[model samples]
Structure formats: structure tokens, C-alpha cells
Target: HKHLVQALRKAPQTAAVGFRQTVQKLAIVVELLLGDIPERAIFRQAPLRKALAPYFQLTQAVRLGNLQRFGEVLENFGPQFRTDHTFTLILRLRQNVIKTAIRSIGLSYSRISPKDIARKLGLDSAEDAEFIVAKAIRDGVIEATLDPEKG
Candidate 1:
């Protein structure tokens, strides 16, 4: 990704129009690669940052476990995501968002029912919440046990 960014930056002025078009698509890919990093140097480029605002917003939503905002970002930027070949990758982050929510819930409460988790995370069913929580525990994202009969 850095190589691509450097190549784009070094492109000749004669290819300014092509550079602009490529930057539109490349910015999101770069943003995705840099999302978890603390010092994201990409944002320093004002035009690239402007182009990547929606992708940046999506990352923020994932980090915060804001499912509603996540959905909104996906809806708003679906075309851009598809064009940049990142739609599937972005979709996969849904689980991360759920796990983040689970971690928050685990920190806040010692005991929480799957039904309550379903409601809190906007999941379709308690069974779904159970599965997500079980995965989170298995993956070491959280430490919790699901008492099927109880929660």
C-alpha cells in the first residue's frame, strides 16, 4: 500500500487526471490498511483525507461498536467500497463490531443474558448473541460463559 501511494505521488503532472481517478479508489484501500495504526500518515494528505472521510467514518463506527453508524456508512459508501474492492472486507468487520460490543458489555456487567445482548447489539435472536459471545470467548476477545438454560 505504501508502494502504491509512493508511486501515485511520483506520477508525472501529465497524468494528473488519471492520478486523481486512481487516488479516488486507492484512498479507501490505504485507509483500510492504516485504520488500526496509531500514526496514520495518510490523513496528512488533505485531499486523500477528504476522499477517505467515509471510510474513516466506517472505521470509527467499527471501533466504537456503533452498528447503526456502521450500517449507515456501508449504505452511504457501498458503491465506493465495491469500486475499491473492499466491500467484502468491510462486511467482515461486522463480527469485530459485535465482539467490541461484547467486550464493552463484559466490562460493564458480570452477568448478561443472551436476550439482553441481542437487544443491545441489535442482533436478530438470543441464539445469535450466544453464538457471537461464544466466538468472542473462544477468540479471547472476552472472558465469559454462556449458560444456555439461564442466559
Candidate 2:
């Protein structure tokens, strides 16, 4: 189990893909390396799971497909966060989190404005929030009609 965690720490970093793909890769690693019969077995082991509880939460958040919860779990990771290649994926995942937040708002308000989404997401500017929403749409994670002039 220590070796399994070590392998996660040692995995090479690369440009991150979508959260679904990232979760799939992490699940595969846990299965292939740890003899975990089920794909999400790391989350099942109480001892090793305790040592890496935040990661377990991360997987849970990903599994639930809730970006808001993913952002909350990310806050729990705190300052001791790992710098492993896998960890870098969170930096990219954050963008998706932002997009998810936007989608949630859109669900409530069909013609929601970018500034409103930015305020809700706590982003620095409306432009950044709009950019994230656009990216999410481009990635096919969402379907939204952009209104640049209204924004």
C-alpha cells in the first residue's frame, strides 16, 4: 500500500485531461498496482485510506460528478497538498470546477449573466468566468448559448 501511494507520488506529470478521464486513470492505477479487486479499492481500505483520505474524497467527488463538491474537497486538501504529477491535475481540474459552478447557476437562471456567475464562483473577473464557461461548452461538458454582448 505504501508502494502504491509512492507510485502515485512518482507518477509523471503531464498536461491534464478532463476530470472523467483523470478519474478513470487514477482508478486504473489503483486496480493495476494494488490488487484492488474493485476499481475504487483505495477508498475501501481503512488504514491506507486514512493516510490519503483527501484523495479518497477527491475520487468520491469525481464519482458523484459534482463540481461544487469537488471544489469543496479541494479546499480540504489544504497547504500540505502533494506536488506529484497527479496533483498538478487538480490545477487543471479547477477550471472545470469553475465551469461546473457556472452550469449550476445557469440551471437556476437560464439567461444568467457572466458577472453573476463570476461573483458566485468567486472568480476575479467576469471575463475569466466567461472563458471557463466557453471552454466547458467547447469541451462538450455543457451546452450553452453565449451572449458576449450581454455579458
Candidate 3:
């Protein structure tokens, strides 16, 4: 991603038209989605920040695990994401979304049932919640245990 940004920087000033800059912006979005770059890395640049406002919102949604806002952003920018070929990559952040939700749940409650977690995270089932919770624990996103008997 950095290399792509650098190459864009090296492009002749005459070629720095809207199209080329849009490509640069899309590349930056790809990097951000992959967690390969920080928001500040792009937002510090006024042009890129202004050009990529929608992507920034998407980033914010992902970070906060605001699945509703995430859906809104995707719905609003579906064409742009699809055009840039980032729709699938953005979809891959589901795990991060679930992890962020689990982290928040861990902080807010000492003990929560898999059923409650499933509902809170908008998951389809308690088993899915259990798998996500276990993954979150294994990934060090949260510290919790499952009580299958109690559940």
C-alpha cells in the first residue's frame, strides 16, 4: 500500500488528475480496510481525507463495531466499493466486527450468556456466538469463559 502511494507520488504532476488521485484514494482505502494503515496516515493529507470521507466513516464504523452504521456506509457506498473491487475485502472484516463487539460486551458485563451475546452482536445463533466468543478469547480480544451447563 505504501509502495502504491509512493508510486502515485512519483507520478508526473501533469498526470495527477482526478482519475489518478481517485486511484490513490482507492488504494489507501484498501490499505485501511486491511488494517495495514492508520486513519491518520491518510487523514493527515487534506486532499485524500476530503476525497475519502465515506471510507473514513466505514473505518469508524468498523472500529466501533457499529454494525448498523457499517451497513449504512456499505449501502451508501456500495457502488464505490464494488467499483474499486473492495467490497469482498470489506466483507472480510466481519471477524473484526465480532471481536470488537465481544470486547465491548466483556467490558460492559462480567458474565453474559451466549444467547445474549448472539442477540447483541446480531448473530444468528448461540452457537455462532460461542464460536465468536471463543475466538475472541483465543485472539486476546477479551478474557472470558464459556459455561455450557449454565447456558
Task: Please tell me which predicted candidate would have the highest TM-score against the true structure.
Answer: 3
Candidate 3 structure quality by residue, lDDT tens digits, 1-151: 7777777777775756565557666675666556444456665455566667777777787778876777889899989878767788777765666667788889999999999988988778999889988888888888888888998
**lDDT tens digits, residues 1-151, model 1?**
7676676677774557456546645554444444442234544456566666766777677778878888999999999889777788778777766777788999999998889989999889999888988988998989878787877
lDDT for model 3, on a 0 to 1 scale? 0.75
Per-model clash counts, in order, read: 0, 0, 0
Each prediction's whole-model lDDT (CA)? 0.73, 0.58, 0.75
The order of the candidates by lDDT, greatest first, is 3, 1, 2
User: Which model is ahead, 2 or 3, in terms of TM-score?
Assistant: 3
Worst 10 residues of 2 by lDDT: 29-38
lDDT of 2 by residue, 19-123 (tens): 323444455334423323334664554434444566666655544446667777767674424532455555455554454555566667768777877777767
**Highest-lDDT candidate:** 3
In model 1, the Cα lDDT at residue 119 comes to 92
Looking at candidate 3, what is the lDDT of residue 29?
A: 62
lDDT: the better of candidates 2 and 3: 3
